[model samples]
Target: MALNIVIMAAGKGTRMKSTAPKVLHKLAGRSLLAHVLGTAEQLQAQRTVVIVGHGAELVEASAPGPGRQFVRQEPQLGTGHAVQHLNGDVPLIRAATARALIEACGGERLALLTIALPDPTGYGRILRQGQRVLGIVEHKDATPEQHALREVYTGMMAAPTAWLKRAVARLKNDNAQREYYLTDIVAMAAADGVPVVASQATDETEVLGVNSPAQLAELERRVQRAQADTLMEAGVRLADPARFDVRGELICGSDVEIDVGCVFEGRVSVGSNVRIGAYCVIANASIADGAVIHPFTHIDGEKLGVQIGAGALIGPFARLRPGAQLGDEVHIGNFVEVKNSTLAKGAKANHLAYLGDATVGERVNYGAGSITANYDGANKHRTVIGNDVHVGSNCVLVAPITLGDGATIGGGSTLAKDAPAAACEDEEALSTTSAARHRSSHARALSCGLRSR
Candidate 1:
């Protein structure tokens, strides 16, 4: 039999008290309807149709892609009428519960996905004889005795497409609300000598619908729990699972530890033995093995991604923007911001520094309050620090410049031109305070207070 999937999304969701359609509300960073569509995609049905009503234009515009077909239900009547708008071919339900109904459907019998709830108030009671399902009686129409039944219909059903159309055609709006009831088909099927079946959902959370803000929040937590469980099962240690939020994909290796209040977005990957501290927001970055990202660090790899090498240590409050790359054993301390820069092995920028559009070489010690002045009004430039360079506190290396190997820049100095290898450049010209000193790679000390050549 050709399978067709119909999603009934025509209701205005007055209980939600919002202008946006309830199905378009977010659950786990995706619209609720999108979540339903994702499950439907797994079925690979012959045809998929979404019935839209309130906020139809917005819902259709925000919908994920091109293949889905849509029909509108103007001045929505009821659930039965919503399904009828599709002309009755395929299964019917809120998008949230489609997967269970589709999976439970054997396609030969009329199937309803039912749940056993402690409080079955306002729900349609599932009537059964022996092991066979008889019908579903809505609480408003059910007798006092039938109202006590715990198993209730979940507004989801599957049946032969032809039979479904015929049964719906015979439906009447004779109920108290004068609304067409889809549940009426269960009794119609049983009366016609057709077998009616009920399938119980394994996890009740999967069928939860978001009709209000409170309900949406609860659903978000449920989704977060699932994401956390998957990570935990893979050996990732989370300090507090409740405090973690993953808006996008997060790939983790073994022995990875994440602290409280972390939000990961846009496809981040953490390698083995990595530790991410509290309140960090990391997005689209790759953190290598043995890397430790301290508390409050922000790494956003927008367009151009950021990479942290093995054994690299970053932050207690640092920002790494696009194109920041750190080689093995590099250290970026508190309050440092790195953007479009690459720090080679053993490089250290210990505090209050900004290294943008720069290349830092091995064993370079960049002091506190130092910065690479890489942008000059209209154009951007680069600063290069060669091997074994020692940049003093509060100095600024103006871009389009370089500090050769074994160079020493004095405290509070700003350099526009390149500093020669093994040279000492001091800012204090008047106060001969032995301004700056440098020892050559051969261990020979240069004369103190020397002027620039």
Candidate 2:
């Protein structure tokens, strides 16, 4: 059967006190309208009709595209009146339109999405006669017994398209508020002897309408909890799910461990056996298998995302910006920042360095405090380091330059032009610093070599 979704979203939401439409307000990195459309699509809704008003264009754009269509509700009417604006805009849902919709959707089953809230104030209360629904009583007109009933109707429904069409036709606005209430359709449906079925989901957050900043915040927490729970169920260890915030989509592999104070912003993927340390903020990035992102790493991939290769070690205060691509076993240590740069396999930028707009070669040892001066006042440039290069501390390799293979850059050397890394090799270090080369590859101690004056 072809399922169709009708989203009623024409309210001004005066309590929100903002210019933007209430449905446009976001909960989990996506607009509330987007969330509704997504859920409806998941239910295999063949067509979605969004009733738009109050920045109608913005609301229409926020809803899902392709199969979705929009209808305008002008003059800012009440719920029933807003729906009445269906007019010629919607192919379905007009007076006597339900039968046409049923023919289009291959009618087999119908269900209304609703919730049962604890406090049923300001909503229409459901009136049930035995096992059948009688009608809906608005909160203002509900009797004391009806007021005590917690079961309320969220203004979302599904039925045989024909019956729905008739219900809308019979709706009235003769009330104290003088606003037409869509809930009146329930009485019509019950009176017509049409069988109406309702589907209820617990956790009122899904059906909560955002009319204020406070409600928006509450919904945000609910949405985040759902995402966090999904991640935890996927074997990703989170220190505190409540403390974590995923603003964008996060895809994680097996055994991924994320510590407290972590925020994954945009589209991010974590490979198997990955460990994201505390206070790390990652966005629009992909981390390969077995990678360890240490504490306080802030990675924002933006339009052009950052990619960290397998078995890489990053952070303790690392910032990987857009266009950063790290090869296997790359080490980006404390106070290191890489922007629009590529670090080759086994390369190490172990501490206090900036490699912006640069290309680094395999097994290159990027020294502490070493930087690629890729930006001048006028324009940005690139620096290239060839294979097996050793860059010394406090060395600044200016932009639009390249170092040859097995090259050595001297400590305190500022190379404005292309050169070899042979300036500070271990062979030269014997005569220069008179210090033995240690077992480790990276510089552990500064060899301030002097001449026997």
Q: Name the top TM-score candidate.
A: 2
lDDT of 2 by residue, 51-147 (tens): 8888888876655478878878886656775442222111112222333334432443234344578787877787776756677788898889899
Return the TM-score for candidate 1, rounded to 2 decimals. Answer: 0.80
Q: For candidate 1, which ten residues in a row score worst on lDDT?
A: 84-93
TM-score for every candidate vs. truth? 0.80, 0.82
Off by over 4 Å in 1: 84-104, 138-147, 168-180, 191-193, 372-385, 396-409, 413-453
- Evaluated at residue 244, the lDDT of candidate 2 is 87
RMSD (CA, Å), each prediction? 6.1, 7.4
